[model samples]
Structures are given as structure tokens and as C-alpha cells.
Target: MRSAGKPRYASVMTDPADFSQSPPQEAAPLDEFSLIRRYFHHRQGDTVVLGPGDDGALLVPPAGQQLVMTQDTSLVDRHFPADMAPADVGYRCLAVNLSDLAAMGANPLWFLLSLTLPEVDEDWLAEFSRGMFELADQAGISLVGGDITRGPLAVSIQATGSVPPGLALRRDGARVGDQICLGGVTGAGLLGLEQWQAGQRHGPAIGHFRRPRPQWELGMALRGQASACIDISDGVLADLSHILQASGGLGACLDEAALPEDPPVLAGCSADKQRALQLQGGDDYLLLFTLPAAQPVPRGCYCLGQVDAQPGIRLRQRNGAVGALTVAGWQHF
Candidate 1:
């Protein structure tokens, strides 16, 4: 029986013995298209000429601008904890890649994701996509295309952005007397890692590690103003060293007194640990750049030091003593 404006459906219950004569029914839990629709699919944005479908995507790069691309990989227990929320993992996977584009003073446009999971978990995918797409939308980036598969938990994102020609920031323009600047403080990510490893998982440190904000706008604002730039993916000291090496083997002197320190998060930590977190720890993802001595540093950035013709990094302690840095920074190898 059917009601007005309502459709009627019939239920079919087949016996095992009669299955040989009937057509087969789908038994697989979820297909790829279904998963994509339920999770990653969203309305197209301005930059998307054609969004996620078909063999590829069409993106309209801003006219008269260069396309900048960067990719980042996150693995279970390597980039994040095994017990970390899927949402946080999703957020960081994109944040790190955005940091790369920011270092080059690019405006985010679109991204592609390649995700691998142990199995199909709808709930996890939903949460993950929520976190990832929310940030993408906030930055006006379109979800262009991607691939999903079964494997150990891992995520890789390739992000693309646009920058005006000849105005992109680089690491080789540092000059003597240029000011070394930081978009924000460091060590919060390391503090978060320490707390996670020590079984204390909820705190500001953990929050910093799980959800780092990329300084995209600040980078864009710095394009013509900054001489050399890099995002602190590794620790500040190490990443700054990269600029030094790139700029014809120059050097820098950091004023320890000016560096931001989160004492409460680092409370009860050893002095060595504090230094390591502040200097050698990685994953901060903040911007580090050099401005000409005559230029005013943009708001929300801290002046940390000055570039020098000397060939290594030196830190002037709060006690007025200079210390030689033996450890350059975080090393994967």
C-alpha cells in the first residue's frame, strides 16, 4: 500500500538454495566513490575550475602570478601520536604544508590529499575531513583531487598557491645588518611532545603540537619587505642555520633575552630540556625571516637578532655571555 506523494517499496528475502538462480547483490561495505562523497566532497571554490572527479583537476592560477607547491607527510607515531584525534591529525597534515607556502609568500589556492588507513572507518573519516576542510575553507583553498587506500595510517597533502613573479621570499637573500624576525614564539610544540611522552596529554603544549596555525597572511605581507624567509618546520635555531648556510655562509647572533619563553609549560623541566625545546626542538611551523635594517618589522612579529658576515650561529645569553651552538637543529637522520 502507498500513501499520496509517497512511494512504496517491496522487501525481498531470498533463500540460500534459490541464490543460484538469482542475480548477485553487492556485499562490499563501502566503495571508493561512496566514501569520497560522504567525506571529502564539498562545493567548489573560486580557484577550482573543476573539482575532485575525473582523472585530474583544473585550477585557475591567479593571472600574472607563479604557482607554488609544497607537500608534507604525516605518519602514525612519527608525526603524531597513535591516540591523537583524527581531526587533529587532519588539521596538522595541512597546516605543515601551508607553512611551506607561507615561507615563500604564496596565497593558498588548492590542495590534494592522499590518505591511507588501516580500514574504512566512517566516523574517523568524517572527523578528519571536517578538520581538514574547515581550515581549507578558512584559507579559501579548494579540494581539488586525491586518492584513498588501505594501509598503515598515513596522510600526504600537496598544496599549491600563487605568488607574484620576482616577489617570492627565499632563504638566500639574507644580508649583513638584516634583522632576523619571528612571527611567534617557539618551544610550545616541543613542550607538547614532552607532555605526550610523559603521559600528560592535555595542556597548552599539546594544543600547540596538535593545532599549529600557519602565518600565511603575515608571509604574504612580508613579500616585498623581507629579504630572506623560511618557516620554522624544524627548531628555530636549526632553521635559521639553513638561511645562514644558504646566504653565502653568513651567520647570525640571537638575543636570548628577546626570545619568547613559556615558563609555565616548561616548569619543572631541566635547563637542558628547556634549551633543547627552545632551540633544537622541531615542528613549530612559525615563520622566521630577515628584514632590511631600515624596514619596520610587521606587527605580530618579534625581532630576534641580526644577520652578520660571520659564518656561524651565536646566542647571547640573558646573563650577557655568548654561547657557541654545537647542535645546529633537529635532524631526521
Candidate 2:
């Protein structure tokens, strides 16, 4: 199920609509407020009692539920290529943050944007708004309020969601004997980046990197079934290590042969490199979680291993030998 080509949000109406913008043209530079009024303001969801245009947006929580909030900040040349399309920049920033809500098993509600641009480019702003709103609409999340100012190119989003008071998924509840699992394969995100850097315009890797989907529905399905949950923002080994450490320094053993096959784009790569890519590549955005041994794992999830009382990760090779596995993954610093 590789999604290839421009993301669904790529084709948007040029006419005024959700977060409408007049056709781009030469105009006087926009002041901060003018910028907000044109590109950042849009119809908010029901959760926003009063949105954008006030001291602060007033929001109401759902009855019998608690709020789940998360934020992610991305920068040009660091999080994305310096010359990436404004539309893709908008979609990628927000979509990645929504994955956090999914990990918490929360229902999408509203979000706030804090954008910094080096210049007020009307053409860029129009495309950016359309891209952001397209994903926002699909996720059932609305933009309530935010800030915009002059600075380097940057995108920050604070996504808010609701979950039944006691049922939010977390990373600390996993234990020995729980089966470790993943919603999908890895390496695609990094492969897409390689494709982009290589100047290929369209392919599975390009689509995966530019517009990766959050595993929201699967997360919701795992609310009661999963013992512990997290999304793969860092590589799986790194993110899974968090679950292990949080759950009291547990360990796990993975079956090498049981790992999902490499994405078709990686077929030309060597076997060892393929394994490393699946384990260490970042940005796949798949949910990595654990379930009780006796419980049936959800469909579409690959059961990679079983949590153990041991202190570190181990890999069970196809021939039956088990060896210590070093847990290395994406480093924030």
C-alpha cells in the first residue's frame, strides 16, 4: 500500500474557499496583522468557542473527556530542504504533530500555528494555507489561533485532542511478555528523502517523505488493546527504546526473518543495509506499541518481538542464534 505521487492535498481549488486567498499578485508588503488576516484565518471547528482575532482563543473540552496536546517545530534546511514547496512544508509540519495525538489515542479537535517567514510572499502564503487546511480538514482538526512574524522559515504547530479521561494510551504501561508490534514498515521515509535529494520528482519514497499519514485510526483501535503505545518519529529502535526504559528498563527479542520486507524502492540494496534501514530510519510515523501475549494482535500490525525481563534488546537470527542488539536511533541533538 505504497502511496506514490503528489499527496492528496496537492490538488486544491484556486478559487476562494477554506482559508481563501485572492489570486497572487504584486502588492505592498503585508504587515503582521494583514498576513494573519489573509492566510492564517479560517473557519474553526466546534471546539473553538471564539477563535483567532482575540487576546486568546476560547476553547471548550468535550464532556467526560480530557485534553491531549502536543507541539512540534520544524526549520528550513534542518527539518526540510531549504527550497521545499510551501504547500508541502505546511502539510508535513502539521501532519507530523498530529501523529503525537494518535500515539495518545486522542480524538482530533483543534490546533494553533506559530509560523515565521523570512519575507511576506503572497504566492507562497496562498499555497501554504491551502496545504495546511487540506490536512487539517482530513484530520478533523481546525486552526483556532496562532502567531506569525518575520524571521527564518519555520513551522510550529500545537495540536489538541480529546480522550476519555482514563483511556489515553501511554508508553509506561508495557511489560515483560507483551508482544512488540508496528503498524507499518519503515525505511520509506528516509528512502523518500534520498529520492528527493537525488532530484526525482515523483515516486513512493517522495510521497512518503512529503505527506506521510498519521496512523490515527489504528491508534484509536488500539486504545483498549495495546498495553503501551508510541509513534515512530525517531527510528523504531530509538522510539521503542523509550517504551522499554519508561516501562522499567525491560528488553525485547526480535525475529529477523519476521521483519517486514523492505519497501520496493529498496530492493536493489544489500540485505544487511535493508535491515538497518528498517530499524534505524526515521519519519515513517507508524505506531510502535505492545500488546498482551494472549490477546490477538490487530490486523495490519506486524508482531516483531516479545518484551522480556532481560535488560537490553536482542535479535533472533533466522538460523536460531540470538545476539545482543545495540539500540541506536535518531538523536535530537
Candidate 3:
């Protein structure tokens, strides 16, 4: 059953447009090796002893540093729309993974992409690679090695990073009296996703949904300063509970009046709606960490509250009423 004229790794021949779902298409048969060479293969860092094309990556561990690795998968329709641009899908795949490294106070190093695609289209590959490498170049990480196989569209990225021994941020280090902090505003991510799904093409909310900036530099800077750190991929209440529960059953009392309100993208929403969005939105990849009360807070970040020895998270209202912030964020289930 050999095709005498095709290369060993070449897929069955067809114009990429012939396959149905949603996308821009190009004329070229799907060829595995050619796709890898054109898209994922690139010059790597000096420490990469061997990169793509090898069965596995060969990397040199940094002196006195511990490696941190995290993986995330995005599926079509589940994570994003099927018709979403290829470039957005590619960029988001890496950004989410990098956010994990940020939460750990680690610096970007290299990443492996396990990409599953329905078919290989030259234009799709071009845009996808452009978006992925754009961030990789900016973040100083490089593509190492991974596998690509034909299947339902999905993008899974495993990112590797490093930090000096005994300095990595974690969920368990928070303590009573530590100040709860936010890297930036939240709620825009949900707004953006709503707008995108409703067919609105351009706006701040849509932009935030498409391109979330991982708080990498800030996370790195917080090393040895913050007590615990976690990215707000889930909603604020959900992610904060993670910090609290992990820190020996600690709790926090947040100042409701202190949270930044109605960011420009959310200006049209009612106050209650805005609060729910802030507390329940997912994909706000900002870093939410706790710091000592005496430590100088970084500029552009917000001080949300203080960790407590109590058993649950609560909020202090402007009028002095206290209530529990018992709510779920995003559940993969």
C-alpha cells in the first residue's frame, strides 16, 4: 500500500480547503515533515544541545536552578471557536502555559508543542507559526521538540522554565497577615469572550480574550518577596480559595471597595453584573499572589486584602458588612 511518488511522511493529497469546518485554506497536501520544518522548527538557544528533528530534546540545566514544567490543552469549540483565526489559537496555546511558569517565579526557557490538526493548510500553518513564535521571541523561550498528528483540532503546549533553588513561588507558602495582591484588573476576559461569541470583532474585551498577557516579569520580580502565587485563570474567588486552602487552611478578608471597578471594557455593565464578572470570569491570566504587609508593593498592582487564620474567604463591604466569597470560577467539568 505504498504511494511511490510521495515522501515517506507525506499525508494523502488534497487542497487544504477541501476539508470542512471553518478557516482560511491553502493549496498543498498535508505533509508532516514539511509542516514541522516550516512551522515549529527554528533556531534554539545556546543551551539547547539538540532541538527539533531529534526524537527528544537535549537541554542543559542551568546551574543552581530548578526546572519547572507545565502543560495545557485547548480544544476547538471547547476552549475556542472552530472558526477562530489560526493565529489566535496558536498564540493563546503558548500564553496560557507561560502563565504557569509565571506563577512559579520562573523564567522562560523552552517549550514543546503537541499539536493535533484536522489537516495541514499552508496559510493556516503560516499564521499559526507567526503567532506562536511572536510570543516565543518576546518571552525568550524557544521550541524544542514535540509531536504533530492528524485528529480533531487541539493545541497542547508543555512549557519548561527555571528558578533558583528554594525560591520558587508556590501555593502553600501563604500565611496569616500576608497581603493579598492582584497583578492587574480582572473581568475583561469574560467580557471579551462574550463579545467574540456574539460576533463583535473589535474591542478591548475581544482583544483581552484573544491575547492575555501573562504576568511573567512581575512574577519573576516577586520572587523572595511574595508568600504565595497563582495565576487567575479561574475567577478571583476560585483562584484565591486555592491560595487560601493550600496555605494550611488559611482564609482572606478582601476589601470589596478596593477592587478596581468597571474597567473601560466593562463600563456599560450594571454594578452587580460587574462584580459578578470580576469574581466569576475565567481566562484572566494575571498573577494573584500574597505579600508581607510591610513589603513595598509593585506599581500598577492592587492590594486586595489580607490573609487570615479564619477558615474561609470573606469580603468587607463599603458599609462595613461582611460576607463570604463562596463561589466557583471555571470548572473544566
- What pairs collide in candidate 2? 192-205
- lDDT by residue (155-260, candidate 2, tens digit) is 8899999888778999999989999999887877877777788887687777888988898888888888899999998888888889999999999998898786
lDDT of 1 by residue, 258-291 (tens): 8666467566767667777877778888899999
lDDT (C-alpha) at residue 24 in model 3: 35
Give residue 52's error in model 2 in angstroms: 1.5
- Point to the candidate with the largest lDDT: 3
lDDT, each prediction = 0.81, 0.82, 0.84
Q: Which candidate has the highest TM-score of all? A: 3
For candidate 1, which ten residues in a row score worst on lDDT? 1-10
Candidate 2: 10-residue stretch with minimal lDDT: 1-10
Q: Model 3: clashing residue pairs?
A: 192-205
Model 2, stretches more than 4 Å misplaced? 1-27
Order the candidates by TM-score, highest first — what do you get? 3, 2, 1
Tens digit of lDDT per residue, candidate 3, span 1-333?
A: 001122322333343323332233454444555567777787688879988776788899888899999999999988877877888888888999999999999999999888776765779889998999988888899898888766788888999999999899999999899999999888988888888888887888788888889888998999999999999998898999999888889888999898777688787888888888887898989999999989878999989899999888898988999999776788898
Model 1, C-alpha of 200: deviation from truth (Å): 1.9
